[model samples]
Target: MSEDNPHSSRGSASKTWLERIASLFNAEPQDISELEHIISEAANRQLIDEDTKGMLHGVLDVSNMRARDIMIPRSQMATLDIEQSISEILPTLLDNNHSRYPVVNEDKDHIEGILLVKDLLQFAFDAEAPAFHIRDLLRPAVIIPESKRVDALLKEFRQKRYHMAIVVDEYGGVSGLVTIEDILEQIVGEIEDEHDDAEDADIKKMATNVYQVSALTPLDDFNERFNTTFNEEEADTIGGIVLHAFGHMPERGESIELDGLMFKVSKANSRRLLQLQVISGKPPTATEQD
Candidate 1:
């Protein structure tokens, strides 16, 4: 008999392992839950990473969500008045730091068109440019229904090559706006740029005596930064302390006073607080006193 080839045996073993792995993914998942189970199984087996697994689930979640679910409410939108001169418009643009603005009449519901910041750059650089007219540079705004599915909206965004859309209610009233980035954020989590506060920072000074604070900031850290004696034993984080003081879950814009500090819920979801606008009420610190 011919001597058995050792290489052939090793090759056969490798092929067998691959087939077993292939079988794991061969079956069609029966439903969303089944598909999630398959993805979880793959993660457990080290076939895919934890981050990839989360994104896969995010994609699945996005399919069930609507435009209204992630839209920036009308009250919070940064818009420009169509009748404003460049001098008046520039301040609002600079403060909001947005690339696009909805050009509206006196009422936000009366949206004129979208203004792209790049269109104004010609006036800034060219001395011989014609007088700036907001209407001359307006781009047609894309409108979508508030009930539009997020996944479908994302597909349309990709196909149309547009970044932003105005969302409207059933009665044709502008409810809010949603962007491609907002939908993508659901998949990849928050996409922070240089202007955004560093992820590790707990508190950021917004303006005179006003600060934007992460709800997750430790009570000890808050005390050290602001010269307060809030008891850490009662709650570990500023969020926990606020929750305890509220006696119930507080919605966005709700305000509370604790230990000379004014805490206003700046960002929150139905489940928990995400951020707070804190106004310092404590007596002047030693440096300020001096």
Candidate 2:
């Protein structure tokens, strides 16, 4: 008889338990639906925790999502007017506190180039420095089509070393913008940056039925405060709960109802949920209902 193939046996033994479990089904999932089911099963069997499962799902789904799905809508993008002076631009930059800005001419559609705030540091100390011009400090804008898949764009970003990309429509009109951070958020979750707003913002009751809840509000806290049971194992934040509900990134004005609460995406960008308008339904009572 021939000698045993030790390498083959070693390879089989090296397979992870999860991989072995998956191999019993098939070589690979036929489609996303199957893949989702596999992930669900894995979670149910305690093979992977909910958070890791959710992130793995995100990593898969992000490849199918287009730039428009996650791009910050043009209306929400902070841009610097090319005509504005340093004094005028400083406050705007400070208020928004963004590291980069798309320099524009007369209209937002007319993007000149990107501006890095770090470039302006020189002007802070020397007021008598040569006349400052936005054009002089501009970095070439990386423009991408709205149809571009995030996964492909992420590869391009890594190769090019560009952090931001201007998203354009079919007619070559400026639609919105996407950032490296936005793409990374898909794989690893939110990365708090200098652009983040007040960290202390909390859920506030507006009226009898309506309430404004910050995206950062913990799911447990939300459940306790509202007296509703939205039991979620994967999601910690209200935004994450909503994301899992939709099974994709939801746009502004999109809404979902869960466990007697109506969650409307009141304020959100392509990347993360900012605020949600939650309208409560009747609270549960101890007595049984016929």
Candidate 3:
């Protein structure tokens, strides 16, 4: 009776440790900020790893974000023209290297359906495959409002087994596009693959006269690349110059002529521009006849 039971002593110590751990999360978080604080505290105490804590925060961030916040703006969308022949559309498919493309009738606003790249594999590989029509191969496109919640859209994506959705404004006009991958990126971070550009050069040639320029590219670098004298004193980066010229934040698809060159906003978010598609010369315009 005098000798303490070893098992009982060990059990008592385990109970004390468990109680201490429980006390850390005992208080219910009154708000998201409070919950975030608790998550951070858990990470501090080694209850959860830093990565887990970050993912939890990302989940919270996604809950508050909407389709408009992350959707790829219409101008940057790689689409297939429904009227184009298979041979004509092949080049676009190859250049863009996207798994899916929105089949549009005449413009981005007139989406017909979705085309899966896999569906074209038979035509490419099988010599005996029957002639196919683009209309016959298209799958129905899912359309969602720009204000749709990212979390809710993600849930729908899972339930419906679809990966992409066309985002529309309140006026029922095509706004942009959102994908399940985009939503997942918010949770697990950027999901880069083999196709993703490993070296994201600030300025890179995309076509004969079109180039993709990073918004953060130094003005000096752009001047050197394009052989133009843009005053660096006004702005350090090309994006800054464009922003100054706009007098406000510009949305994707907006274009401005600078130093005789056309700079089209290709990729952007609410806060700032991310990428620009620069044309070496001013875009062609129709002449007004008297």
Candidate 4:
């Protein structure tokens, strides 16, 4: 047999873009479905360059993020109490885009462990089950120091197959928890699971002068949404603009005034931005801005 494909000539054919890339992946070993999903996502994102692709791959390979890096702060975490019945919480889970919730004893501070919706299903559905403390089904929350890197954490999670890790601050006190999805979002964009409602708006135009947008809004979409003349030659979106404008990477709440548009980083991490505050402005998109 030939070293390469014996049926074809020692050359390439002008197949459509996707088909060619598809050939590069092992259909069985690599899961062609995921391959198609990645390319489709990339195409939808309008990110076709080798550079961005390489950067994305690199970021994903090394989750060099700390617990303070990506954990949804306690204020943002959706949790459950040991007293809350599973029957009452299932609907809440469906609405909150969460597969698991922390089961706290006294409060979230005294988190006993996590309660996965899957594990609680039978109890919620079974009428004969005795009343039990949420603590009964809780799994000890994995705790990691705030300084952990995203890359190493990903490996740890994969090895132990852990889904969540609590982050501790300088005082070694509970800060927040990081989930598998949170780490993955560092590599890719926001990932909505089955629990996400169909009607949630990722980006909402709050008013004629405002937009309550998600942190994960892509650069191109922001450009289109605001009708602003942004320079994407060096970077692709407003988040890119912030990184380039600061002349260094930034964290959440960092602000950069560029051509009357102040990008107040509404959300970010050492990895990248999650959301930005696009100040109210009426700029034309007809010309590029410096």
Q: Which lDDT tens digits does candidate 3 get at residues 26-115?
A: 744347776677678778979889888878777767777889877876756789899888999988876666899999998999999999
lDDT of each: 0.80, 0.77, 0.80, 0.64
TM-score to true structure, per model: 0.69, 0.66, 0.67, 0.58
Better of 2 and 4 by TM-score: 2
Q: What's the candidate order when arranged by decreasing TM-score?
A: 1, 3, 2, 4
Lowest-sum lDDT 10-residue window in model 4: 198-207
Off by over 4 Å in 4: 1-57, 60-63, 87-91, 197-213, 216-249, 253-272, 276-290
Q: Candidate 2's C-alpha lDDT? A: 0.77
lDDT of 2 by residue, 124-183 (tens): 779798887888999999999999999999999899888999999999999889998878
The per-residue C-alpha lDDT of model 4 at residue 245 equals 76
Runs in model 3 with CA error above 4 Å? Answer: 1-30, 200-290
Model 4, clash count?
8
- Residues 60-118, model 1: lDDT tens digits: 77877788877766766779898899999988777656789999988879889999999
Ten-residue region with minimum lDDT total, candidate 2:
281-290
Instruction: Kindly report which residue stretches of model 1 are placed more than 4 angstroms away from their true locations once superposed.
Output: 1-30, 199-290
| Consecutive 10-residue window with the lowest summed lDDT within model 1 | 281-290
